[model samples]
Target chain A: MSPELARFLQDCEQDFQQALPALCQPPGSDCPAVPGGLAEAGAYSLGNGGKRIRPVLCHAAAAALGAADRTRSAAPAHALELIHTYSLIHDDLPAMDDDDLRRGQPSLHRAYDEATAILVGDGLQARAFEVIAGSDVLDAAQKVAMIGVLARASGMQGMVGGQYIDIHATGTDMDLAALQAMHQLKTGALIRAALALGGIAAGASEAQLRALDDYGRHIGLAFQVVDDILDVDGDPSALGKTGGKDAAANKPTYVKLLGLDGARQEAQQLLQAALTALETFGASADRLRELARYIVERDR
Target chain B: MSPELARFLQDCEQDFQQALPALCQPPGSDCPAVPGGLAEAGAYSLGNGGKRIRPVLCHAAAAALGAADRTRSAAPAHALELIHTYSLIHDDLPAMDDDDLRRGQPSLHRAYDEATAILVGDGLQARAFEVIAGSDVLDAAQKVAMIGVLARASGMQGMVGGQYIDIHATGTDMDLAALQAMHQLKTGALIRAALALGGIAAGASEAQLRALDDYGRHIGLAFQVVDDILDVDGDPSALGKTGGKDAAANKPTYVKLLGLDGARQEAQQLLQAALTALETFGASADRLRELARYIVERDR
Candidate 1:
């Protein structure tokens, strides 16, 4: 990883951590704090260390559009991470994936109670949009656009729909097309939304937005394909979560549909596709290009 | 009920039902339908025959603001009901209320699975904001404002916070002030948001929005107080839900904190306060007044 990209991610992580607590506060309230453990539980899950990939993608996309001030992307960046964190929390529920660990630590449901985990996830999802709606950096139109994109990506037709399909498809013979469609909604939509949000925040042109979206679509699928590969072969310690659970659960994956070598080839092709989409941009898109490679090549 | 109020509510219900299924579709997609039963489960819980109180309150508040076109309030109205329906679905989960019934039918988790229920609730909440964000009737500023209001009300400091308190307060003695604060968030916040949303949709003045909020707060309290009373005295068949569950679970309630007569008297006082808050408005607020009365005086 380049020092510049690492520094950018580190800065995003620090800024997001600082801004998140205040985001959990209810809007237009004079109260000094949220009532009880609700906020704490929310912070616990949201602050759980993860790759912060979505925020990086958002910031990189904005930079790709020649946005000088990174702060303009803050609202959408934070919102994307919050949505991502919330999905992880919900997906870890006993009724869902039934995972006991996340990010190398006890999952929210295991650390707290199941109800707390559920409510905190719900609260975080609301706070994600609330952050964008109350953003001072973005104009009203931009805020509206970002909210529409994020909500659609996070909602039924996107993340939730993907989960629904995944749960039903478990233990069933899901074809490659069906598997790709599920991942497209499950993980791909949010990744695409992250890029779109950054572009919207940066006031990208119509063509630029389409290019970012095209780049996002390839990387989004590539991210999931790599994830499936990692589950089959990556070290759990480096991954910060259990690997091989996907196969254990009998859920279909790229690694299962395609041979391991085929999955790796698919990832490389997607990385190239993602890079090709960014050819229209100059040096400003270098970070986006690098991030695409990282997404495909990261061991974790 | 007054003829005008009944007719208005019926119209809101009909319009909301027709608009809801389409709202579940992924934005900007050519897909003719949602991938699976996800939309079906969302429709089932959302169409569960609740009173449509939030949507009616929204439309009524818009009318009270002298907005002739009720269609202006449609986005917020639909958003309010979607949020309300999502909350009910989440509240019925096994880790939460553990209820098998809602609006006289099987709860989402009971009718479907827990994973489906959780995902549907999450989807509905996202779709609520999407409706407002994607509204043709509202401008960008109005959409941003409405999203902020609805998200805050449905989020940590509001409904989710209230549920957290309720879960923690169970089997423990809670005082009047503590109970009121809890109910204020759990139920009051969303009710208040309904009116505020309607007023915002109609481009209400700041003072008028405050008045609607004042009215909402009073009636919001009144709604809960009456609910507590009904749990003790009303028929389950009329309520369309199991009554006495609060007492059965040893959860705190107005009836438990204040005796049944005190709770009844409290409801009446709140109803009066709600009516008083609308004194600045003329006959345009008649529906609001009638609704306030119905909230406190209804048998079910």
Candidate 2:
């Protein structure tokens, strides 16, 4: 990996970790230090280490729009990661995936009781929008627009809607088109929202927002495709999660339908499509281009 | 009931029911109608008959502020009710209260599976914020502020925090102070937000907002006190829910600390305090004063 790219990711991770706890804590000093188990449960799920991909994407989109100050993007970046973390917590519930593990550790429901885990996910979801609503950096209009985008993506029409389709589709044969549509809502919508939020925060134009969204859709699907491939072939320790559980659960995947070679070829094509969406921008878009390749190539 | 107040409440209920379904459905025409079980579960829990007091309170607060158009407050009023419904659904989960009935029907988790109920609660929550963020009537700044208020009230420091305390406090004795604190967060926060949101929609002055909040806190406490009184003496069918369940579960209540007569006396005192908070306003606040009395006097 290039040093500059690696440094950029590291910085994003640091900012995400630092800003997240403050979001969950109460605003006034007189309030109790942590508010007990609900706060603890939220913090535990968020603090578990994972790839800070969404926040990095948000920062990258803002940088591409020529936003000079990284701090300006911090709230949206953290908010995206919070939303991502909350989804992971809910998706791993016993009633949902019934998974016992995530990020190479016991999942939130496993670490805490199912009730605590549920509240944690709900609280985190609320906190995500709260962060954006209370943001000092963005103007009111920008914050409102970002709120609309993020909520739609995370709510029914986006991630939650996708999840509803997915759980029902499990153990059933689905064509590529149905699978793609499901992923677009469940996984793709948030990825697209992350980019749009960054662009919105940076004051990007309507055309620029459209371009970022186009770039996001391709990478979003590619990300899920690579995830399927890793479940079959990647090392569990490196991946930081139990591998091959998707197939064991009889869930349909790109790897299952397309085979290894076809899935790899599809990933490359999607990566190219993503990079093409960023072509109008100059050197400022180099990070986004690199991220597209990374989505398909990351072993974990 | 006074004829004027009765008419006002009827109008608020109509607006709430009409606007709520539109909030759950997707925006674009292309998306599938109703989005299947998750959406169904959300609609089912939300559609069940209730008093619609929160939305009525919202409209009352707005009307008091001299807002000429009732239509302008519809979105915020409906959004507040959605948040209230979502909380009730989650609070009745098997892992939480383990209740079997709500609004005279099987509770959400009983009517649907536990998983569906969980998702329904989560989805409705996201929809609540989406309604505010997407409201065309309010300006972007107003929307942002409303979002912040609702999110904070529904989040860990508010409803969820109260639930956490209530669950832990069950089967244990509690003093009046602890009981008040729990009820304030659990029930009072959202009630307070409802009035504040209405005032905000009407562009109320800071002092007016403070007055509404003070009134909300008093009436919120009074509502719970009256609830405790009814649990012991009221008929279950009339209440549209299982009454006396709080005592059955060994849950803390004002009646548990104060005697039944004392609890009733406290309710009356709280009603006076609520009415006193609106002294600065003239007859415009008559609905609010009557609502406060009804909270203490209602049989069910």
Candidate 3:
């Protein structure tokens, strides 16, 4: 990664770190009415070390759309990070992915207890909306629109519902199409929303927003395909987490149906499509294109 | 409960039953692209039996605000119901409250799997917003406001946050103040939002909303007192579900702070306050006032 890209991610990480405590608590939670530890479980996962990819995509798109001053887009980007963290929290719960490890530590539910994990995920999801709506920068209409964007992606028509399908078919051998649909939901929905939120934050034009949406869609899938590839070929030490979890659980992956090389080829193809969508932006999209390339190329 | 209140409860239950399928699946989920078991787990909870108190509260408030037709408030009322159910689903998970039984039958997680319970709760939360946001009856602003109400009530600073305090403090004696704060998040927040969502759905005036908010706050705490009283003295057979679980778990309760008789008396006082709030509504508030009474007065 270039220093510029590293710097952008670092900036987002700092903003997310600062804004996170606000997102877990209910709005007006700063009042003494709420006791200490109200946000402890929520903090566990949000504080867990994970790359801020989705939030980075959001900030990058906002900056590309002439919100050149990164400071202006900080709040929405904070909300986006909360959404991403919430999804990971829920995904790692015993009922969902059942992973004992996330970012190389115990999953939220395991780290605390089951109820805490559930509430943490629930709290974070609600907090994400609260921050967006409570934000003074956006007008009511824009906040409402952003909430609409988020709700659709997080709800039944999106990630959560997608998770339901994945669990129901657990142990059932699914074909490639079933697998893709599941990944689109379990991974892609929020990625698409990240781009959508960025455009809304930057006040991008419809044409620019459309292009970013397409870009998000392709890379989102490619991101998952790369995850599948990593599970098969990447070194466990570099991944910083268990790499063979999917196959061990018999959760279907691209390689399960199409073979390891085939999945890598698919990721490459999707990355190319993501880059193609940014062709309209020319030099302005260099960062996004590079990010997409890194998403497909990363080992962990 | 009065005959009229009984009828209203039955009507609301029927409405939930009727709309259950749509609430379960993602809109356009039949696109056959996604893989979630939205229907099966949804049926596990929706097809089972439970009191529809939350939705009824929503409808009653909407009706009190003069949206007489159930169709007009179906979205918010149903959204409230789904969120309530989502809490139940998550609360029943193995890592949370871990109740093996609910509504006189197996809990959703126990009946299915932990993953199913998690996804079911996630799906319901998502579905609640989908129902409200996708509604044609309420304007976009109304939808956003309703989402905020639901999110705040159910999130960390609300129900889930309360659960965290409850679980974290398990096996230790809690002060009266700590117990009350826990219940405010666990039980009070949702009840408050139940009233608020109904009012928002009906586009209630500021004064009416303030009145309802007060009524909601008083009654919500009162309802918890009644629950704790039941945990101490009620008969499980009559209650139709387990009542001794709180005591067995050594969780804090109003009965623990105030004696059983004192808790009952407090409930009665809160009932009067709720009734006073409804004094201006004349006959339209009859059902709502009765619900406040029933929420406290019922043996369960």
Candidate 4:
């Protein structure tokens, strides 16, 4: 990884950490005390040290679009992370993936109670849209556009729909087409929204937005493909969660259908396609390009 | 009920029912098939027969503000219902309220499964914001403003936070202030948002909006106080769900805090206050006034 890309990610992490606690809290002086300590539980899951890939991608996309202030991307960046964290919290419930661990710590449900986990997840999702709608850095049009993108990506037709397909497909045979379709919605939609949100925040032209969408689609799938690969071989300690659970659960995956070498080749081709999509932006898109490479190459 | 208010509510219910099925489905032709039938599960809960109180409040508020076309309020009205339905679904989870029934039918988790219930709730919340953000009826500013109101009202500090407090306060002692505060958030916030959303849709002036908010707060508390009163003596058949569950669960309630007759008197007082709040609007707020009285007097 380039030092510049690493530094950019580091900065995003710092900014995100600073902004996160407030996101979980109710805004304004009239905030009622949540005697249940909901904010703490929300912060616990949100503050867990994930890679912050979505936020980094958002910031990079804005910078790539030549936004005068990359901080304009902060609202969407944080919103994406909140949405991602909420999905993780719900996914870890006993009725969902049933995982008891996440991000090297007890899952929100395991750490807190199941009820608190559920409310925290619900609160986080609401907070995501609230933050975007309330962002001072964004105009009304921009806020509406970003909210549209984020909502569609995270809604029934997007992440939640994908999850619906995945949970049902467990222990069932699924073709590569089926696998791709599920991942596209479950994981790809939000990833695509991240870039689109960043572009919207930066006031990118419609054409630029389309180009970012293309780049996002390719890398989104590539990210999932690489995730399948890592699940098969990545160290559990490094991954910070159980690995190979997919295979154990008999869920279909790119690695299972395409073979390890084939999945690797697919990811490489996707990386190439993602770079091609960014060609129109020239040097301004360097961060996006590096981030795409990092997405596929990173172990965790 | 006045014929005018009844007809207005009927129209709102019809509009909401017609728009609801589509909300659960993905928009656009490229939608992937969700084999888990998530859309159906979402539609089931949404389609269930509820009082449509929030949407009615919204439409009434809009009408009171003299919107030329009541349909202009559809997006926010539907969004409010979606948010309300989502909360009910989550609140019924085994980890939360653990009820097996809602609206005279099996609760979402009971009807489908826990995972699907959680996902549908999550999806509904996302779709609420999505519909508002993507509404053609509302301008960008209106959409942004409505999103802000809805998101804040339904968020951590609002409904979810209130639920957090209610769940924790179960089987414990809570004073009148604590009970009011909890009810204000859990139920009052959304009720207030419903009115605010309607007011915004109608382009209400600041003072008019404040009047609607004040009206909402009084009736919002009245609604809950009556709920506690009904829970103590209302028929399960009329209520369409188990009754007396609050006392059975030892959850804090107005009845417990204020006594039955006291709670009924409190509802009457709140109803009067709510009516006073709308005095400035005169006959224009007749629907709202009737609704407030209905809220306090209704058997359900």
- Specify the highest-lDDT model's number: 4
Runs of candidate 3 exceeding 4 Å displacement: A25-35, A70-76, A168-172, A204-208, B29-36
Query: Candidate 1 at B42: error in angstroms?
Result: 0.7
**i-RMSD values for every candidate model:** 1.6, 2.0, 2.7, 1.5
| lDDT score, candidate 1, position B116 | 92
Better of 1 and 4 by lDDT: 4
Question: How accurate locally, in lDDT, is each candidate?
Answer: 0.89, 0.85, 0.77, 0.90
lDDT score, candidate 4, position B222? 97
TM-score, model 2 to reference: 0.97
Instruction: Indicate the residue-level lDDT of A50 in model 2.
Output: 87
| Deviating ranges (above 4 Å) for candidate 2 | A29-34, B29-34
Off by over 4 Å in 1: A26-32, B26-33
The residue-by-residue lDDT of candidate 2 on B1-300, one tens digit each, is: 889888887876676666676667766773434357777777787778488878888888998888876766777888788888888887888778888989889998899877677777777888888888888889999999999988888889888788778887899989999899998888888899889998999998999999999999999999999899899888988998878888899989899899899999999999999999999998888888899988889989
lDDT by residue (B248-282, candidate 3, tens digit) is: 88877888778888888888898899888877786
Please provide, for model 1 over A169-243, each residue's C-alpha lDDT reduced to its tens digit, 9 standing for 90 to 100.
899998888888998899889999999999998999999999999999999999999999999999989998888
Docking class of 4: medium
Per-model DockQ: 0.74, 0.61, 0.48, 0.75
